[model samples]
Target chain A: MTAPEVVSEDPEDTPAVLADEVEHVRKTRPRTNEDDMTLVGSVLGGLATTWLLYERVLPFSGALGFFVSWYLVFLAFYAGLTAVNRPRAVVVDRVMTSLVIAAPSVVGLALASTVVVTLSHGLPALLHVNFYTHDMSGVRPSDPYTTGGALAALVGTLIEVSIAVAIALPLGVITAIYMSEVGGRGARLVRTIIESMTALPSIVAGLFIYSVFIAHFHMPRCGFAAALALAVMGLPIMARASDVVLRVIPGGLREASYALGAGKFQTVWHVVLPTARPGLATALILGIARMVGETSPLLLTSGASSFLNWNPLHNPMNSLPLYIFNAVKSGVPRNEVRGYAAAVVLLLIVLALFLLARLVARGRNRG
Target chain B: MAGSSSLPTRTSLRVVDEVEDVPRRVVARQSTQDLAFTHGVRSVGFLTLVIVSSIGIFLGVQAKPTLQHYGWSFFTEYRWLPNLDTIGIAAAFVGTVEVAIVALAIAFPLSLLSALFVSDWAPAWMRPLLIRLIDLMAAVPGIVFGLWVLLFIQPQATHVAHWLSEYFGWIPLFKVHTDVHYPIWDQAPGFASYEGSAFIAGIAVSMMIFPMATSVMREVFSEAPAGEKEAALALGATRWAMVRTVVLPFGRSGIVGGTMLALGRALGETISVLLIISEAFKIKWNILESGTATISEVIASKYNEATPAQLSALLTAGFVLFLMTLAVNTVAASIVARSRSGAGTEL
Candidate 1:
């Protein structure tokens, strides 16, 4: 494996069999058989030379600088070495391959840095047990990490998001059923509308609710209103995803039930819906994931409050997203840490929801 | 599962007797079922329609005052100063388009290349993992990305922005006289208050929108007809050549649709843009300089503590943002629909 293999195609290129796997229509992926030691050796050499040369002229320091520069230097060194023996096409292919890989590597770096930074910055507050139990009441942002917790924001978020789910889940599932099962003349239009609704921005959703319920109707800035705003944003997502899940249900299942002398209604109720239940559950999780971290919508609909408010109907309620949104803007280190802690909590919840979605989806063995 | 025995042609019996024999007895039962299901579903279905309609009408009604006040100037004028009862969304509209264009420019090509690799070029073991990575990018909350940009990217981005302004200043878009505020470890104070510039926001948004573009293009490329790919390869085409001839042209509509979809998202993006850009009322040509305010950003930043007139103005801005996204989405939807047809019903 020291030398690169330039074979265009071989029997080894056979596409792996996976359920519902598309793509890989062409059973040809160029093999890169370069020696691991040489690759790592070149990268190390590139790093040494780049550090020496760039230390004087380049304005980068520490690991970040090394990490960023290694890619550029390593690519040049690796490709330049490869071009010494390989044809121009092989060199070009290898370079392009590295560049493509780099795109995602950079994105992965950003995502990882986000999580790590959030976790590390929030760790101080998280070490305290009361962080989850206590509210922000009587807690100063400048006070020690032992003082305040995200309890109020946590409860506020739970209430708002749950209420939103309470409203959106049933309606969204019903709409999805309508689209997939009872589709008719307005089905196309409803579908288009739902698709567009999926594009509806959080701020816009907030503005819609703010104007209609708050300004026009004089509704208070309560968690329920915030929930309504979230519902508006979450419904189309749930409906759209559920419709997709429902559509993927085999038509033959319906036919089988019909063959059993079951009407369309019975077939849909007993066969289609039941069979697609897992998928629908995934859709529901995804919809909740979509709305749970929403900030702009809650900011407008639910006025921020520092105290833990029990009633969501008549008074201001603070959500975690909005709390973070407010806290981060203060530009204080402690406030920033608090925001980061809240963010980590929200991120963990969304991660759990997505995992649940994937977990629930595992039972469905699509043919 | 659509078992083979259930196939109509495979059936020994026409099954008409099996179906018809029970219908007479089951009609009563099924009619009630049908009525209940249809009635239940239709009412909920109609509610969806109402929700959609109401979102539009409610926003429109709220925007009426602003629209009446501004008339055509609402869209035409560029200056936005609401407290003094003088405002128009011209600057915000241009800023939104500018930022979105810059974002698309960066993200579009990268997403296409990534999608190509994930769908056709990557090793079998890597493809699913990379595809899942793209999905993960899409699943992450926008606020997390915003915070990342704020905490990490902005301080580092100033160097790049400074380098561009220093070297590529000959270009109009790059011509800016902004100071580079390096991290305090290297220098004194880091942020010069303009760290969250338009270009930074654009790049941050590119990260956010990249997943969407990749997903669409991956789906399109994956749907390329297997027969055509085999033919292209059979004709002695290289992998790249085969992709160009077989996959790319097939996925062209999908690419356009994906780009347009990403563009729409970038336009209406609030949290990230709000976090990254310093609010400004007027449009500027230099992307590197800070003070970029998009329509959605304007609403998010200004909705609180806004006077009635200001609130109305922000609503008008939100409405405009809505319509713009709607137009983009409709186009994307149509393009995707057309691409599905062009894929020739393999779905």
Candidate 2:
């Protein structure tokens, strides 16, 4: 309403006023009834034409093909319809707007599909009480879904991740502290090394531990070895995250501490770490998230086992990722179902960690 | 560091030292605790450096035997026949690049558009939520993506593959060798040939890396000079035009750096490709055909069944992959670090 009135009164002020006016407007144009009709007509025309091409004129078939052709046709119809009335810039802007909006919609749909497909496929396995309590010790792939569970893999995951957390958390924190608080030539070197370590493939981490621990040292293929591999994978992530967090702490806090005659270590311990506590927790949880879903690192280190194993030493243990990998590729339909079920559990756990990290980080932002 | 900036320089302190009986030095007295702390932290830092270097050293040592045996031919040879004592990373290396290229093709545009949406187009209240959702996507496990692709996407995607091969089959990459000709494209070109192809695997890996690349680009795009954006808009440019003039150019290096980082990740992605691809050891460019191999996938698959000699060969391959990713990541990190958008942003 205001756009046309303003334009009619002072036509030369149109571009500048409209540009400022657009800051308040939600869209480039205040969509009119005619614009709405064009959108609806183009869509309908696109669908009709696509149906004619796919079903009658062209031999194209399949839902994906139909939808894709329809979308392309719809875009064309829209461009043609809009070009008839609007300027070239407006037409291009409108097309780009639709495309920009469509991008996130596609991403959202992909996420929804992954969750929906995983839940739908894994629901049956979750329905069984035995799926949580019992291990797959004697349960064959031929056995019914009620007969076995991922308890062993769960136990192994808990033990391995616990050990990894114990090892990586402190080491990672120390490394971060060393880089940020103890800045020097050595700190720069360590920071560079840590940055590159983030790129180390998870499988290579497992191989490194395998070659060093089992092959060279003649150690057993056990949960402990897997924990070391997980530590290797998690440490760089943890350190890098912590370094960022530590850097974000106000420099004024450290200066105040030093002004009060506090030593470097004192400032770090009493001022810096305390100020960045929630952030450090976020980093730790994010590190754990990275470690939990890792399969390749455990593949070479922790040999798979069917029974529950609590200890990190002496014997083979199975984690959720390895269990899922083995189960899905087992070439059995029943086992494949269980694998999907395990994946659902893993996904839920990771989602939970992500939420926790977000919550903790958000709290720090507010403080 | 804040305190250090305020402290006197060594030359200034030396001038003070030259004045005897006066304050001989301006240097603050180091407490024992501070000295101990410095040493302790430095040693721990060096220990981490040692730990990291040892990985490269260990792989180097393990790869030595294979390097000595196969010489430079190890990288050039495409076949892996342990029995014949002929193994090389050429096929897997090419496949890795092919898969990474395809993933970049799909992921880059989506990430860019979505990143632009999140940074500039999204409502203020919705921005954080969208960012969190992208982060959550990153948090989703790769193996789950493998399962999704295997059970849900692969069957559906084969048709899309057929569509590509039908229309765009003139392009060598889209060309899949099948008896069915172009005119009878509606007739099955054997969807079996399309299953587990590089196209499908790339789609799977693209989903995995999309979040990672988006976050980087979004971070940089959001940091584009707001004043310039408004100036462009005030000069009668549309929002898209403003973005093109200001944000895209500002974030150009960020896009390259982020995409390269994602490419490094795509090259290292193991489980999804391992599941989706049917292993074929040849240098083929037909992405629509049903066979591909990546270095990480080959390592995971062959490590279990490999003999001692074959194990050395696998380690040698791992070394190459490590070096490849290392180089990419180093260059990417340097670019990201040096980019103007990153100057005011936290790393």
Count of backbone collisions within predicted model 1 = 0
Number of backbone collisions per candidate: 0, 0
Per-prediction share of native contacts kept: 0.42, 0.55
TM-score of 2: 0.92
Q: Score chain A of each prediction against the true chain A by TM-score and list the results.
A: 0.86, 0.89
All candidates: interface RMSD: 3.8, 2.4
Question: Which sections of candidate 2 miss by over 4 Å?
Answer: A1-30, B2-5, B8-25, B181-189, B340-347
What is the Cα-based lDDT of residue B284 in candidate 2?
Answer: 81
In model 2, what is the error at residue A21, expressed in angstroms?
27
Per-model chain B TM-scores are 0.85, 0.91
Scanning candidate 1 chain B in windows of ten residues, the lowest lDDT window is B21-30
Q: How does each model score on TM-score? A: 0.86, 0.92
lDDT of 2 at A347: 92
Q: What's the lDDT for candidate 1?
A: 0.80
